[model samples]
Target: MSAVPILGVIEGFYGRPWTPAQRGRLFARMAAWGMNTFLYAPKDDRWHRQLWRDPYPEAEAEALRGLVEDACQHGLQFVYALAPGLDLDWADDGDRRALAEKFVHVQRLGVEHFSLLFDDIPYAVDRAAQAREQVSATHHVMDTLWPDGQAGLLLLCPTEYCGERAAPSVATSPYLKALGEGLRPGVEILWTGPQVVSTEISVQSVREVNEILRRPVMIWDNLHANDFTLHRVNLGPYAGRPLELRGLVAGLLSNPNNQLELNTPGLFSLTDYASGKSDWTPEASLDRALEVWLPAFNTSSIHRVSLDDLRLVSHLLYLPGGLGPQAVRVLDVARALVNPQTGAEEREALVRELRTVRHRVITVLRALEAGPNRDLLFDLHPYLVDVAEELQRLIVWASHRGEDDPEVFSYRGSLADRLMTLGWKT
Candidate 1:
């Protein structure tokens, strides 16, 4: 309902960057979802980060040019970002010139949007002095590349880009204040809310940052990012960001799960929220997303089990307290069946439902093993195997109620240990 906010995706994770083919696919998807921007800032790319002063090799440059053309054809802005803070010599003009030249090279490849990142670098004891130097160095590059403010779009991610890292506090931090005042008016700044992976981003928080920056802050939302832990995959829908947030900033760009397929639901849900869909709820949005997602794994005929259950038992692994509605339903049925007072007919019915759930999970697992999305299967494979084992143990325990079986106890303990490693509650 709110004017569609500037929605975009940033491939800014720390792990292996997405392949060129994968990136092309992402651009097509972003276009379909009405996303307008694509930021190229992968941390592992040496030319983008460590070798920040060097130009891209011809082969790589040609590939990037094709990607930029693809993005433009899809009506997406390809923002080429460079992380020069890792080893940039802020005091050296030659260093500044090299940085400017890199941008110029990218600009020649039809990239008009640019970003300079100074995140994840050591902080100086003289915070204000360092902040001024960083701003000055960035301005020098921007001015050289697009003199007199002719740059199409320029974004900066300051070293103290988030609330926790902003020494003292955002309002009182001399470093941030310097950035706000020293940076040119046309340059946009990127801020990750409160923390790198904030659970919630309130309007008041954005307002405070906006006041200090004297401009609408471009948000780098890490809601679905998983590079911090390989075991985790944040498939949850985009919540905690209110629709009113559209009015508070320049745009919202999410750093999503490393696995491209897993990011679809959250991305779609974000688009819906930004588009003012009044009926939007993370739960409902996830349901609609899975309706399309599950079938891709060739499990469309597996009946009576919902995607919520599938996620809880599988994809939602590696996060604490992550049981989905289906998993909960199975747990409830198991508990009821464990009661000695339960009638035989009711027990049989619960057993049938449990078996159906188990069967569907197996069907999904097999399909994944043989499907094109098998890499995703590999990521979720451990959780799937454990869930299947747990279900079989549960069914066996229920069938022989009140029996003291040492094997059952051993299996239960092993399952508990596995769940704990995956961040699930016992």
Candidate 2:
């Protein structure tokens, strides 16, 4: 059997609503690039409200249907993304029923592909209650909407950040289990594993979720989206280059939010890359990763010397020795010292008090490694080699620390200053 076509972004071309002219142009462009699917789910677009309950005036509804028809003619499936949880906040039972009615209405529009987007809903809510309610409502509505029970494809976005939020590593929530039970057999789950923007997926976890949910898992990768604290690390091409997110999956979806400012050529090239038509090499993908990660590294670049530059010194010392529990703690301290948060400053008093302590510790280690101290050096050399390997990783990660927190710059700057004073080389 052939692989399912990769889905590309359908939201915000040029960072704004696609005027009719723009939509037509984009539709043709997408089809030409071998992209077969476009997810039409815009967060801020009120016009999409027409897809539910005929909210749009007659003329507008006709216009939307026309767009759908055009998409079908071009051999592309336009997936309607219904913001059930985000837009239709079901604070009460009535709101839930109303949402169901809207789903029924949209089903009448001959729209085959549908997505129940529960993403971005507050996780603090009674998740179990929300899941059951959504499942029951969806099942009930789709029953009435498609009496024959032959609904086309259904996509469900569970209440977590699929590819952007990478915590709660395990997807064994009770709410999710309940959702699986309530889901109609034909429903396809858009499973967002706990690893947001994760290049390496835990296949065991993937298998576990599939077995539990009893649905084919389609990975929703946010390759083009850049969310640092929440979802840092861009996974897609940045400069009209291809960033192949290689993975063993049933299908791939590029969930680009409103951030991508892709030009026509860039868009087409990305579409080709996603569709697996273009030659996407691993080297090319790594190059794209570097482009996205390099800027962050620049913010936290460290000079060779400046042991007084606490963070860099700690990085240099800690990495080569291996990342022990104490090592991690010291590095954290160095990081905090260099770019002390307001609260950190109030507690540490500019980290001056700890300078002597840090220097003493390094001096002792160096003494242990002295040439005449053969036994100590012999024991420490192996450990130092191990530490060096880990330190290299730390350096690479520190170089990009600014991607998540720009404040890491303060540490980089102070480290550079200390290095210059100490006459250290890069």
Identify the candidate with maximal lDDT.
Answer: 1
Which tens-of-lDDT digit does each residue in 142-182 have in candidate 1?
78777766558888999999899998999999988989989
Prediction RMSDs, each to the true structure: 4.6, 16.2
Off by over 4 Å in 1: 1-5, 299-357, 370-383, 386-426
Local error of candidate 2 at residue 241 (angstroms): 16
How well does candidate 2 score on lDDT at residue 115? Answer: 74
Identify the leading candidate in terms of TM-score. 1
